[model samples]
Target: MTEHTESYYAASANEYAPFPALTESIHCDVCVVGGGFTGLSSALHLAEQGYDVVVLESARVGFGASGRNGGQLVNSYSRDIDVIESSYGADAAKMLGSMMFEGGEIIRERISRYRIDCDYREGGLFVALNHRQMSTLEEQKANWERYGNSQLTLLDEEAIGREVASERYVGALLDRSGGHIHPLNLAIGEAQAIKLNGGRIFEQSPVVKIEHGSPAIVKTAHGQVTARYVLIAGNAYLGDKLEPKLAKRSMPCGTQIVATAPLPADVAKKLIPANYCVEDCNYLLDYYRLTADNRLLYGGGVVYGARDPDDVERLIVPKMLKTFPQLEGVKVDYRWTGNFLLTMSRMPQFGRLENNIYYMQGYSGHGVTCTHLAGRLIAEALRGDAERFDAFARLPHYPFPGGRNLRIPFTAMGAAYYSLRDRLGV
Candidate 1:
């Protein structure tokens, strides 16, 4: 059985009963694959709407990026609003802007309605590394404001230091609507809610083949799900061969994170005075936040080929200490890595296969909140309301250049150029 990685979130996640693997064939109104945020959220929404839902996961729930991410609920898509407007025109941008914050809202509503204890916090900060980046943030603040985000504040150098005891950042953008959470607990809680709503979930049931028809048959190792509809929510960790076409549109990249031993209350409070999650405005950015237990959870470091590094701590600690020099000898409690799907355009790809098979993937690294929005949209589409979902689907997506053999090297080259621009403050 595939298990969740040994990380801080896994160690601290809420306890839940193990879902039995699929051992018999079943039929339902909806057959959802992938047990992470998108699949679970889709199941929860469909179950609430009186649909017979069955979820199949290759591993345990939250075994993928949903559980191992930085835990920040950063709003907005991977490609900024400006890119959306420029690429797809103003009409598409206006539509997307309206729904940018809905994902985070869905998360908040679920936590409250289900009483899920995921250590929910209420703020996030985008720190600027230099004057050029601050200028970009000023524009970002304006763009978000035009989109009905009223909880934004741009902090100057003095305010930036006050918000995060870091001298590396010259300024910061604070978004009250963005926050952090114990992501794995959120997933597990939603899974429990799915069961309560009469939906069935089967873990360790990796899909072998999906036979598309009037009622699709999703064959797993031990069983099959015959359903009228199928929603493919698997992102990076989707190792199955059900969709070679969709897999070609995205490449998985690895990111690592480390958690320090719980710090003294006073020291923790001093590090981030307001307890806001923080991420820099760099091409290769660093994000960190204080856990509910006062430990510093820091994450950054990219592996282009989706290859896990040998020493996660060695790769991450120096980055953390660079942002905060006082932590010279802090013991790293836990470290792990996970992969997220990336698209060439850096925008999410949402579309349908045949008539009833739907798929959502390629949120890049900005999926924590986007996945929640996707679940709602998918549910809406299933209920004959595909207007909003279609808007996202209509956006153009291209396969990575040079195909799978050379896509990694090609992407790394593009990233290197941007990283240089970030370092040069261009």
Candidate 2:
């Protein structure tokens, strides 16, 4: 068994193929940096197209946020729909919404076709913790309908209670298409698929620098890869040295989660009778759902200027108790924190830094399904199709106003404002 941080998923990761470290210069059709979901997915898609591909990971596969997320495979871009509409207008918003709807389907298809055992479940709920939130959900439902997404069903407080244990929510918008899965398992499975397709994945092979041109060269500690193109899918874990320009565009926000000891099956049923994933509409939202083993995996709290896991349980456990006081007596078995990137616009940043070098990151906690779609689009772009990739490439993204020295302060202030809004219920 591999040594891993104490995450529930880590405790259960399936045994997977071991990838060798890149030890010598190599050549390929594409050199993909970051072996998380996006890189692995791109590698698999590109390899299936018969392109020679090499994936480099700084640590073991899925060691980044890919392995540590809350695992909700949600729909909708990380930004609010209104933001998308106001910025891109109705047509572009409609297009983006349709793309996200299809993104969910892409995840389902991949799971079925690959037979991945990631504990996937459909039926997710977005709850409104108060009347203000309920009204917001109504507006969202109207907007989604305008975009021709009629599958969203509005549920009143009574219905919400039936689906979730918390009386905190006044109503909810149930999108059957949205769901959750074992994210780490999905990442590992995708890497396996890439290998089975004859692509190469080099674990612990961190790309220290890239020489970009027609045939890009990615240099690692022990080896280098020369390829026709490159893809940077490092997301939040793209350490400062690899791509400083990309790193400056987003701030790493630390989020924490805790899973309780398994509740009796009946008790778990009362909490989420339908076994649906639930997230409230708060700026710093509280998301919780039951695991397959009947544990309440609660995720909440944001820590600025911190990466230590020691403070995670203290920050999140209270929020969890507030939602489910019933779990007060239950033992908290697993607690961990993961860093995710948050862009100013909350939209994913995707485009090529150079003509032949492509990069995708800044999903803002909405990467579960979106990353998979991004992988496919990346593969398509590598294979001479750039239409879909161009749509996101054109989405505006601004770097954090202050440079490194002040970026954290700026983000902390922004987070404080959002936290106040969440508290004021505005």
Candidate 3:
């Protein structure tokens, strides 16, 4: 059995009954593979509608990126609405814009209806380091406003300084709707809700292969699941292993995060007066928030290839200190790395495999809210309402410029170009 990684989330995770592994062949109306946000959300939605559902997880709940991400409830895709409009057409963008904020709404709905204790906080900040970045943020705010996001307020230098206690940012965009949470707890809580709705979840059941057909069969190491409909929610970790076709189209990349030991409440408040999660506007941005226990959780830097670094603190601590030099000499209580699936388009990839099998993945780095949105969309499609879901599916997703053998270096070069532009402030 694969145990959960030793991260702050795992150490401080809520206690729950362990789910059993699949030991006997089982049949159900829907077989959801993966126990993360997408699968859990899909199962919960379907279960609420009285569908027979069975969830198979390779490891414990929230064992992958769903658990290890910097817990920010960001409210957009990796490639924002403007990019969607420019790349696709205005019509396509309009169709997607309607659902842009629905993911965060679904998250809030789940939290309220089920009472998931994930330290739900409200508000997020997009801090700009220079005039160039601030200009881009202004444009971003306008674009978001065009799509009906009226919760945004631009903060000038003095206003942001008062809120963040930092001089690095010239300004910031405060999104009242965007917020942060204890991500792992959200996942586990949703999984528990799934069970309450009459869904069965099997942990430690890695899917070895999936037979695509009208009634597909998902085979695990110890058992098999036969279902009329199959929802493939395994994004970064299971794509290459179980579905090679999807593998050629996406790459997994690693991001590191570090959690400082609990700071004095006064110190924490001084660092972030409003307790809003903050991220820079750089191509390779740094994001930080205060944990429920007052620990400063900071994350940044990405490895093109999804390989855990030997030292997580070495990669993220410097970035944290640069933003908050007041945190110098603070001891880091936990450090870890997690992989998120990235597509060449940097947009999410959603589509159907064969006839009854559906697969959704590739959130780039914005999975917190998007995954929950995907779950609702996938459930809708399965229930014969594919309009909203099909809009995302209609977008095309291609493999990286180079194939799998060279995708890492190719993506790294593209990121480097953007990083240079950010450094030059042009």
Candidate 4:
């Protein structure tokens, strides 16, 4: 049995320097909770603005979903564009689209400027498994074009086959601007940059309580932080006590991934020749791509409750085989699962609780790019600019009804509905 969590990225984490635990009372211009992408990104931007920032992580840096995601730097919000346009009006939808486009650019620039070694790759294909999916892609393409996104290319089956290895997809949308990167390294690099800019980060120091109001006080087990602003960027893994109201706005869903042993160069090339990340347009999607070392990392399936790493592989490896029968005999070298936050509307939740306590979460599965954008917007809001951030904040969100006691049941009902729809290809 693999001793590690079986996450391919975790097995290959770069040498990250240990951060001191939060053991004493501290003060800062901003105090951030959760050291994943959003928190670290917020810290980096805040520190760059010459603010004294402090970040507190319950576990080690990148210990949550940031380290274990499929690493697809996809654009767009979790909610479908049509839903956004219909619900929030054309003006708000346009702002959301522009923000996502800029998000991709922000990730690219950070990777370049910080020299992060995260196997960053541009170019991604959003494939459609059926004619209905093809129609959806066409609609999506039209939507993007209407919003002035001319870089998106609609690809037929033959064209998609040339771009991807499998002939399973009927069509695809090639987003030249979106791509993938090693997520953990990116998070770590951002933390490093924050520290270099005179910010402090504490790992294994989970915030247990937040005393809301001006100059909020966040208490960890052994320490406390008083700051003019507090940012809750913890997303799914956020414990209940820190911000119970914010936590109730979304449910925690688990996503699983597995990586195959390195394949021969020729074999890997045949599987995914272009090295672009590919995700199908399914309600429960299957996303996979070749690693820098030629291993096939495939991610799919969902669990209502957290399970052991070993169980994660057992459940997902068969899904991988279904996608690539050529990998029938290849052994899965790593397997892991991470929790993701999902809102009732499937849109991210961003806004301040009391004007000074800003929080962002519930990106669903589109966090790689969304979190970076959120960080910048949150920073801008801190600097007294809320125009862009308000666009997302204005999108209404409903708290999960039934509270914590019945949250899982409601989520199960919702998931079952989506699962049935996915099966019926509706």
Candidate 5:
């Protein structure tokens, strides 16, 4: 069986026995083509509602970005609802706005209902490095409040220090609903929940092709699954081979993270007194949080092309130190990189391939909360409640300009431009 990537998450994950690989053709009501958050969530939801579900995973569960991410439960899409309103319309924005906070609610619900011991903690902070970012946070506070989020509290520099213990931020925005978790453990817990609900999961069964029809046939090396519906949830790892059309509009980008050895209790408290997760407000932001074991887990920086960096430490250490210079001599216990699917629009891609083949991918960088939301929407649609799902399908997804060849350089150029603006505090 394939193993999870070497990261702090994998090292500290719960002991889960590997699910067996598919060995023969089988039939089900639905076939999920990935085992990360989206696949497991869709399968679990379908299984809960009495649908026979089969999940085929290319590697171990949570082995992809879902496992290696910074584990922040950030709300809203990469492009927030206000942007959707201006770009789409008021109606489209309202439909999306109603669901902006639902993903975090669903996460908390799963944790409580299933007794998932993923070390979930409530609260998240968006810190601002300059006056411009502080103004943005103020705007965000108003926007989020308009969307019915009353849990938000704007923190001035003094208040920010009470939460962040940092002198670098001008201010911060705290979202009580947002939180962090041990993501790999959450995936494993959800996988077990799927089994408890009678859903079949097959790891090490990478899909080879899909024969779309009334009943789609999903083929793997040793087995095949015939099902009424299919979902392509592989995101960045799906590659250009499995779905060439998807490869055109979306590109994979790598993000790196590093974890320090467990810090002393006093040091941990001084770093993040309230134990809330934090991410700076920037075009390309830096995010960090204290782990359950008192380790300071930090991540930032994006590699436009999906290639892993030669050294994850070299990419992330400087950023971590910038946030907490006191940790100059701290030992980094782990370092790893993972890919998040990026689209030209910086929004998720959701649409239909054929009559029965549906897909939900390209979450950009907001997969943590949005993936769970996608799973619920997919379930609702399959159960004949598609009004909610159609809201997302209505958005137009454009391919990156210059196609695959020039997309990376093009995106990198844009990122450089934004990075410069961030530096200038414009």
Candidate 6:
């Protein structure tokens, strides 16, 4: 019964054919659970490699965070490479740094190879609200440079204003390699590409149980899939009925987004002349970009336990107006919320269960590109190349301190502390 939210992305999504639900037992080389970016990307790669792949979704493809996200194809992990270097060591950081941009590259390569049009734009800006954030961006630029990212430029206050037309930023960093897109369309296009490659996708097929063996059996309400390998990429929206162990290591966090009514083309150009997607540097950040049809898609705010509010637009519109006071009376054309998995360390979780089954989740708020990277690494491991996959698997993950019940308030307190620091520009 899961369905796509009534958001701008859903309304404007490219033609996506409805996939039939699983009604009979079937067999495949790999059965992937969750049909968002991770599962779809993994299935596409596996299908291209000639594996008999089948994807199962609790709802339509891209019905979760993948479709509802802010659509920025940003590079790197959630915690950043410097944090990785400090925690893991120079060697681990170097290895991770090497793969930072590959995820974005994978996205571009797919769009070109498959000729999928998702209104792919080619610029992104990380803005600073104060000197502390600017310093952080300087360090980030230097850190990314060491990792072979040369498409970066630091912008001063004046340059930042010129790039964004907003006076809210003190400085900014532009990454030429970073970009934005219609995320839902990208997922739908990839699903279509997978179908064209002969992979099967069943929508509205919630996995009720998983019976594991040398070959695992994935059961839906009316059908089942027996596969040599089972890859679970169901991140935040994944329920715990199937696997409680995977659910504990990460917590689901909800985020809200609002889209303004289409403005005049000239007014849109005046608002963000460069048309680059921008995100501010803060614990709870605001991200926005101009859509293809001239609407401003703005997103921010978070609920730690993934408890969605009834009035998403009311919660997010004020933040948007705070950033752009000129749009104080702008009509909100669409509003929605989505959940993403968050880990204590702000890093993704990649590991295997029962040898033949694998799972990857915990991208935090940086799923757009990292999911693609995870998909690639998972596929490599399935093909007998486990070196890269093991690298991510080595990163440690911990359960929430207060367990399931109290983790929400505990994490909210921690987030509030950082948010206070951000507000004070500490």
Model 1, 253-314: lDDT tens digits are 99999999999999999999989999999998899999999999999968987899999999
Model 3 spans with C-alpha error above 4 angstroms: none
Residue 154 of model 2, lDDT score? 97
Task: Tell me each candidate's TM-score.
Answer: 0.99, 0.96, 0.99, 0.96, 0.99, 0.99
TM-score of candidate 5 versus the correct structure, residues matched by position: 0.99
Candidate 3: tens digits of C-alpha lDDT, residues 107-207: 99999999999999999999999999999899999988988899999999999999898889999999999999999999999999999999999999999
Number of clashes in every candidate structure? Answer: 0, 0, 0, 0, 0, 0
Model 4 regions more than 4 Å off: 1-6, 305-310
Error of 5 at 177 (Å): 0.5
Which pairs clash in the backbone of model 4?
Answer: none
Each candidate's lDDT (Cα)?
0.93, 0.84, 0.92, 0.85, 0.92, 0.93
Clashing pairs in 2: none
Candidate 5 weakest lDDT stretch, 10 residues:
161-170
Better of 2 and 6 by TM-score: 6
Q: Would you give me the overall lDDT of model 3? A: 0.92
Q: Candidate 6: where is the Cα deviation over 4 Å?
A: none
Candidate 5: tens digits of C-alpha lDDT, residues 373-426: 999999999999989888988788898889899999999999999999988889
Q: Candidate 1: worst 10 consecutive residues by lDDT?
A: 237-246
Q: In model 2, which runs have C-alpha deviations exceeding 4 angstroms?
A: 1-3
Q: Please give the range of 10 consecutive residues that has the lowest summed lDDT in model 3.
A: 237-246
lDDT of 2 by residue, 260-293 (tens): 8889999999989999999999988888888889
Model 2 Cα shift for residue 400 (angstroms): 1.6
**TM-score of candidate 2 to 2 decimals:** 0.96
Give the root-mean-square deviation of each candidate in angstroms: 0.8, 1.6, 0.8, 2.2, 0.8, 0.8
